[model samples]
Target: MALTTDTLRIGINKITDQVDPMGAHLNELDGRLGDGDLGVTMVNGFKNIAAVSDDLPDDFGMACMDCAKAMTKVSGSSFGTLMGISLMAVAKQTKGQTEIEWDRLPDLLQAALDAMIARGGASIGDKTMLDSLTAVIAATTGKTSAQDALAAAAEAADGALIEFFDQPCKIGRARIFGDKTKGMDDPGMVAIKSMIDCFT
Candidate 1:
């Protein structure tokens, strides 16, 4: 199956439903290492994205850009900015397309990951959501169905969390905490995991 604007709308709704309830918890996690507004960023970002869902164009690339713009409108934090950048990267690749095949998801994700790395200056081993995205790209590379891709992505995201839980964050504000971040979850990674869970 292919993904279109309808898929985007449904995905946004699912993610918003899941993220709304976890906002406070996300904030609590960020509080230990950063400004503690990660949850606020996430909550507001998805809310804005949902608000524009119905208005998105038939072109999936343009629709993705609209979602990215909506995200940037609500948040200027590092995480939020990276999210926007990633969406824009995907937009560039899919521009004018009415739909994208599920098999192309890995390439789109890779584009997002590469853009985030270039713009955010975060490496794969940094114990951030980039690591999670990297894992998802690998896991979903050959999957050709939305259900299969989502399940693989969910497992990859969760695995990323477990793999990095004991490692110290190596970038952004969380990195400032050094060893204190070792046993703690990276708020960005957790945010990614939470959203991926909604799809599953």
Candidate 2:
């Protein structure tokens, strides 16, 4: 029910295993609006994270910091960098804690969202992963059970894609596509959904 280094390791392993098969699909989705590297960034990022998961410390903050560093080592992709930034924010908030209650999930996500906003210059309505993260935070708030929180997070992230599917991306390289970006799912949002699905 509580988040520990084991939880982090399990999640990273799940994501790494689940996301590999999604690489081509994600690349195709991003090709329409971005550099077609989103899939690579995600797959490699999680793989790298998994590679270091076993060494994660019980201190949640240090574990998160290590995870963030692993994610950033994948490449110079903006998505990878943002993922690192989000994890860094959470690491700071959860520093020194070996076991975090599920109720704090929402606050952690909020910290991530705020950090991503500040670092990536993307807002909630920008149709990015930030929006998906915002949805997850709203859905998981007040949840004290890990099972409930995971379900809420997965459902909310999936819903975010549906909600923003018809909307044009408002930032990043996707914005350059302008009207064409309309009706296209944001790759980052879809990535969040896919990653969350692994936890379920």
C-alpha lDDT of all candidate models, in order: 0.91, 0.89
Give the worst 10-residue stretch by lDDT in candidate 2.
15-24
List, residue by residue over 166-186, the lDDT tens digit for candidate 1.
Answer: 999998888888999998999
Root-mean-square deviation of Cα positions for candidate 2 versus the true structure, in angstroms = 1.0
User: How close is every model to the real structure, measured as TM-score?
Assistant: 0.97, 0.97
Clashing pairs in 2: none
Instruction: List, residue by residue over 6-102, the lDDT tens digit for candidate 2.
Output: 9888887788787877777888998888889999998888888888988999999999999999999977469999999999999999999999998
Residue 121 lDDT in candidate 1: 86
Error of 2 at 189 (Å): 0.2
lDDT for predicted candidate 2 compared with the true structure: 0.89
| Cα shift from native, residue 75, model 2 (Å) | 1.7
